[model samples]
Target: MRKPQVHWDDVEIGGELAGFDIEIKPRRVFLQISGSQDWYPVHHDPAFARKGGHEDIFMNTGFTQAALVRMITDWMGDGGFLRKLYFEMRRQQRPGDTMACRGKVTDRYRKDGEGWVEVDVWAENEREGVTSPGRAWVILPMRESS
Candidate 1:
């Protein structure tokens, strides 16, 4: 009695997720800074960013972290629960850059009676290649057994 919607069993190792791109604009950066209350100058002040060796104000850790979650949740849909998320930034994402969030299911298994899926995810830009690389573990709903 499996539901028609996607479930843990529906995904396979090496399966590709339908990912999305995020445009990093200055206003978006400011909004994130304000929303998170992370008043880091490197994230919002262009001069400070340059002094820190960056070309311009860049997306902060908060935004990067949230972007990863958004990509995974969007792929797994409403029934999934994100259990663990880990990532590192390799390059700065600045205004005018487009972050393409992509992922592949690296593994899937049942653990503690919960269906878990592991994905290798990355955010890339044309200029910086893979600016962020990470992995995430999510608990997706299992199909009911009849």
Candidate 2:
């Protein structure tokens, strides 16, 4: 059976969007950057990253941000538009580290005839180290409307 879609009015303050847990790997990072045509050597070259003061190549921050959007949009389904996104990089994610993305709705309201939900988002590594924290605003459909 198909699951129900989330309606704008149905998302409450403090509602949580359970996110996917991911492990960072060199190959995956390489593929992501390559596929996106973001060919910064620091994202794919360990030696270069070491010269850059990192133990190894780091995951692209853009990919991480995209993942954050995917997390909330996946829950909101197809009827939502990402309105605003802002983030701060707190720590580096090295290869082999597991990270979890989490989001919590902070407010839900209508503005300019659009249903909007503001959320606080966070990403943490397996050691409970916060890598990036951010805020997102999404526009969702009202109940009984697409």
Candidate 3:
């Protein structure tokens, strides 16, 4: 199914973007690791994760990064183009945790005739608080020029 496009003129600075929730399960972790070709034991082996001082098997940073990007692009839909994305891992997202991916439009502007929105994004879990915090820039097609 095709998602509706969010035009640049429809975006408002400080507006809230649609958010999503995902459960971080062992199977999910395994799939992400496998897909990303990240074979780190801490991402799938509970015992190894615990040995590394984590409470349980945790999602890998790369997976979290990709997930966050997905969150932004998914919300922006087809008309949006990702220009830049950056994030920092603050906490571990373990299996059995529910993560809420949220973000807001921080700024909007036109550059070189292209409209862009800057977004502040984060992923939070009940137990670990903010697991990842990041920012991104997406170009959205404009309906009209100022």
- Supply candidate 1's per-residue lDDT for 110: 90
Give per-residue CA lDDT, model 1, range 1-146, as digits (tens). 53245599889899987788888887788788887789989888889989988789878878888888888888888788999998998897889999888999999999999999999998889889999999999999998871
Misplaced by over 4 Å in model 1 are 1-5
lDDT of each: 0.87, 0.83, 0.86
Q: lDDT for model 1, on a 0 to 1 scale?
A: 0.87
Report the lDDT tens digits of candidate 3 across residue range 31-136.
8878788998888888998888888877878888878888888888887899999888888788789988899999999899999899999989999899899999
Task: Write out the backbone clash pairs for model 3.
Answer: none
Candidate order, lDDT descending: 1, 3, 2
Worst 10 residues of 2 by lDDT: 26-35
lDDT of 2 by residue, 1-146 (tens): 55467888889898899788887876778677866688888888889999988777767778788778889888877778888999888787778888789999999988998899999998888753878999998998897553
Backbone clashes counted, model 3: 0
The CA lDDT at 131 in model 2 is: 86
Candidate 1: deviation at residue 114, Å? 1.4
